[model samples]
Target: MSATQMDMLWMAYGKAGAVGSIRHEDDLFHVVMSDRREIGAYPTLEIAKGALISHLKPGTDRPEFRRV
Candidate 1:
């Protein structure tokens, strides 16, 4: 998938107020974010994206997805 698609997925699963960015280390793209005042680092973009979505509360506003 495209980088933008991956970013969107990551944002969807991230916690409230979380922000994500792509960082390169050792020739790999890492997805990292802040969660509850702690930093969460994911080895794979897919995992990071999943974590964000899985923890979301019901009826949460997803403005990024236009579901607000």
Candidate 2:
């Protein structure tokens, strides 16, 4: 299936404010922070999401991240 631009974009939000976003491009999931910093690219969206969570909240059991 062909994914639209909107479908390729995923935003991650935290309790304080906007955390970051994950964009699917060139068959890779790119994790970009709120400050416009490119974290890294992952093979899957799940992995990309986890990287964001880990970077934001390290050593936390339950790091809350609202996907938008």
Per-candidate TM-scores read 0.34, 0.74
Worst 10 residues of 1 by lDDT: 5-14
Clashes (backbone N, CA, C under 3 Å), per candidate, total: 3, 0
Model 1, span 33-65: residue lDDT tens: 434422345676555455544445676554232
Q: Assess candidate 2 and give its TM-score to the true structure.
A: 0.74
Error of 2 at 62 (Å): 5.9
Q: Write the per-residue lDDT of candidate 2 for residues 33-65, one digit (tens) a residue.
A: 888989999988899988888777665353344
Query: Who wins the TM-score comparison?
Result: 2
Measured with C-alpha atoms, the lDDT of residue 68 in candidate 1 is: 16
